[model samples]
Target: MEKREHWKSKFGFILAATGGAIGLGNIWRFPYITGKNGGAAFVLIYIGCCIIVGIPLILAELSLGRRSQRDAVGTFKVIKPGTGWFWIGGMGVATGYLILSYYSVVAGWTIGYFFESLLGTFRKMGSPQAVASYFDTYSASPLKAIGFHGFFIVLCMIIVIRGIQGGIERACKLLMPTLLGILLICIIRSVTLEGSLAGLTFFIKPDFSKLSTQAIFEALGQSFFTLSLGMGAVITYGSYLTKKDNLASSAVMITFLDTFIAILAGFAIFPAIFAFGLPPDQGPGLVFRSLTNVFNAMPGGAVFAPLFFFLLIIAAVTSGISLLEVITAYFVDERGWSRRKTVLTMGTVSFLLGIPAALSFGRLQGVHILGKTPFSFVEGLTANYMLPLGGLMISVFVAYIWGGRKAIDEVKVGNPVFITGRIWVFLLRYICPFIVAQILLFGVLSEFTSPRVISFSEILRYYLGIIDIVIAAGVIIGGAIYIISIKRAKRREG
Candidate 1:
């Protein structure tokens, strides 16, 4: 058997993992979501969720990967042997591939926009409408959209085929630092604009009153979503780590950097968002449409606009590499394919499959699945259902199936100092799984509801009522009791 590829340094592992977490959402969605929900109020909620909800779940997933020393599918198969648990890993791999198909297409648009920005394509865009029109025109063009998608996927393919230590580690070492540097530059420029203080105040001040029923769930979703949880990206990345690294510390580092970059991205955009007096709740095109307008309107925007878009493209590339790595790792580790063969085959197939999604905004515009466009349907299904289900299953497997002692042992693999094991287990066993299950259940129900576009808060307020709250309370309290009982029983046995 070929030796399993491992990261050369702790920094590489953290960078690779953080690269996976920092994606298009961190750049586009986070800032806008923060602006709309309660500015800094929602950010605090998001941070809290990241701590309790994200860290535990990802640590569990990473522990599984490192312990099993295999891809997601291979990990379950090795650990459980004869059980159906491997399907969780299977689901992760499949979900990653499906997500990548469309995700690459969107990533491609960022690259396309990067070039256009450099070329000063949007220099003359006077209003948000003009920028919106520019996005519509490019996205609706079948040739342009597919071409860009193909380009982005190919770039990822090249990196993955070069193997872990050489390509992924090296790319992230370059990419993550560059991404951070660019964000800092953008934040400085944005915060210094004439009307930027209002934006700063709005982002920095936390007013709890903005907490609505939807905002709570939105924060929950973002916390998980932003971290690349539930999708096996962490699992896949973790499989490559050296056995000497501490899982807990690595997870914390990745989470800290991911959250930091997200907040930095918010600073970069929210200040501009307030300066332009644009609605913070503007939808997904915030980057392509609204931000371009901000760039066109800002001082020295012609140059900075391109730099910002370039950073956006790199952000997309880093995350896309992770998504692609999830898929590539499975084939290479489980199916025994050569890295080159797997990369080429999967890359070709995924790029071809992505063509439909590329056209979804253009040629396939009107087509809908469960009331979502082809592209949106793919995203909604994976993010809401597959990812959450995968995360829930990972939590259950680690906390219950594998047993608490075993999990603690896994977390303690290399580190001499370890205090988070017990609390992390509690969160994974009790809080994370139940909450993710709620996300999964709600995600499914959303498809049938009228207009099919109600918020999580709305879903909870009306149809579900206090049932979600009651369930969550029951799960947390019951979980704490059960864990205590288990430990006590073990102590008595000893």
Candidate 2:
């Protein structure tokens, strides 16, 4: 097998990782979740979770890859020889493919909106009904969505085929900074609106009374999504990290940058919504319709609207590059294929997979997986189930089977502070697994407990939901306890 290469410079790694962490999840999903939850209170808890859980998991993933010097599949095999943990790597690759399939479709929306904003189409739009019609006409058109998705996926493949330094790093070096600069300008403009202060207050002020169990779960889910955790995306990127790189500091920097972008995006989005009297919880429609209207009606509407969407497209594209890279790397490293072959094959597959999502708006609208909506069902399964399940496996593999204390030490390398103390172990052994298990169980229960008029054809949906939760809970608890017991025995023997 040809030996894979590490990033030539630290900045390259940072840019690529930051690109992965910052995406539509920040601009599109984060704001709505914040608005729907207790705003700033949820934001605060989310930041806390990002620091405690996100940073540690990131370091662990990067350290594992750097130490093993292999992509997701080979990384586990190399680190803990003969262990079945490599299956986690396989899951990561599959998750990446799943992510790209739907994500390309969403990215298509951003691209379409970018052009619309540039054309000043929103200026003539006055009523919410007009906005609804605009979206209905454009967003539901299968050909338009497919064309943009195909374009976005091809762009991603071009980057991956160019190899790491030439394609991925070079693009991020220009795109990430440009993304931040555009966001800051938008934030400044957003805060100048008449009702901006109220928007800020809504986002910053913690209303404990508004927080619910569902809100807490939502926060957890957002944190996972925002950081790109549990998708094996990070682990695949981590494979390119050099041993000299400081995983702890790098993880912290990426986390901080990701959080900053999310908060800044809130500042850009919410004030505009408030000023225009638009509902904040418009879900994905918030970006497609609501924000487009805001840009249209703003002072420098023509110029700023296009610029905002352009920035959004760049953010989405950078993240999509990471998603594509995960599967591409798996093929190249594990299957002994050329980079071009890997990218072309994966890109074609992803493009074909995305068609269902793209067509969900038109001719394929009748195709229903479960009784629920098609897009929603796909998003729920991947985001809610596969993501957390992947995270659980990662935590167990790093904290128990592979390296354990050795892994901690590797993460702490080149840093003055060490995380190998009992406190770190306690969280890895107890808190992380416990939180993940709860999320898994609640996710399952919520699916069943929700009122849905069911038919015999849909009976399997409810049964699978129950079975998924049971198995997930059992695996998480079983793995955590088993690992802790082993550590105790090792200590006793010493």
Candidate 3:
């Protein structure tokens, strides 16, 4: 095999990894999730989840990658050789590819909106209704949707094709700082607006009465998903680390930077929403619609409008590079293909796969599979099942199969006095996997059941019937493979 690339510096790895963690979800979904889920209480719970679940997994993945110095799939194979455990990494690579397909379509919207705001498009709209209608019209345009989607893919391809240190590390060094700088500017302007204090109060004040079980689950889920865990992105980035580098500190710093940016995103958005007397829980529409109205009415609307969307574009590109790199890493490591061939071939195919999702907003909006539109179905498949399953399995593999003691030994190579080894292993063996399993079940069950459950029978009838069967079959198949792989390994050992 050819030599592999490593990150040139620890700082580059930190920025690149954190940039992979920070994405459109931070800018749009997180603020809305926090507002509706008991504000500061939810935020606190989220931070705890990060410490308990997110950071441990980050350590596990980073250790696994650095020890093997291979792609996600190859890392598993390197450690367990001829075992079914490598399929976990295969699932991760597949998950990244699946997510990148539809994710790029939405990332494209950010770029399209950035250009639109830059060109003074929102200035022409007089009312919130008109602004919303404009978004609907733009989203419903097949030509524009596919055009921007292809554009975003091409941007990612260019960055990922340049090799690791020169491409991903270099681009993130520029993009992440710029993203934070623009975000600070937006927050300053947002808070200075009259009546903005209402938003801040709502965001910072936590009411225990408002906190629900569902909200707690939401916090746990966000903490896991927000850090780009279980999707091969972290593992792929970790593959470039050196033995001298501290995995524990690197994971914590990446988590800290990601969480800090997410909270800052709330400050940038919530103040503006409350300043304009708009509802904070507008869900996903808050960014495209309500924010447009806020921009139209604000003092420096034209200037800040472009700045905010530009920030979104930057966040999208930074995250998009990592997703594409996940796929690129697989082919380069496993198939021995050149980075250029892998990136171009996989990038083009990813774009083609996304065309259907792009069209789902326009021509295929009415079509439904299993009571969901094409876009929603794809989103649900990955978010609700693949990601959480991947996370849960990784924890189990590291704790039970690879042995947590061995994993920590790998982690402690750089930090000789690493103190959290026992606690981390315990969490991985018991607490973390259970929490991720809850997230997985909630994600799957919530799709078929209402948020307000009135009876046990309701859950049994709506939630458990089909999903339970699917989960059971998966467990059985996975168990069989594990048993077989282990028996084979023992035979080889003998």
TM-score of each: 0.92, 0.89, 0.91
Give one digit per residue, the lDDT tens place, for model 3 in 337-405. Answer: 999999999999999998888888779899888888787888888888999998999899889999988
Ranking by TM-score: 1, 3, 2
Task: Give the runs in model 2 whose Cα sits over 4 Å from its true position.
Answer: 372-374, 416-421, 449-494
RMSD in Å for all candidates:
4.1, 6.4, 8.5
List, in order, the clash count of every candidate structure.
1, 0, 0
Give model 3's TM-score versus the native structure: 0.91
Give candidate 2's error at residue 183 in angstroms. Answer: 0.3
- The TM-score that candidate 2 achieves is 0.89
Between 2 and 3, whose lDDT is larger?
A: 3
Q: Residue 493 of candidate 2: its Cα lDDT?
A: 83
For this target, which candidate reaches the highest lDDT against the unseen true structure? Answer: 3
Per-residue CA lDDT of model 1 for 1-494, tens digit only, reads: 45788999998889989988998879877887776797888887688678777888888888888988999899898878998989999999888889889988888888888888888888866656787789889999998999999999999988888989899999999998999999999999999988888888888998877667567677778887889887888888888876788998888888899999999998999888789887777768778888888888888998888888888888888888888888888988888887888889999999988888999988898988877788998989888889888888889998898877787887787875465567778777877776787778777766765554555536565444245446546655765786677778778989
Model 3: colliding residue pairs = none
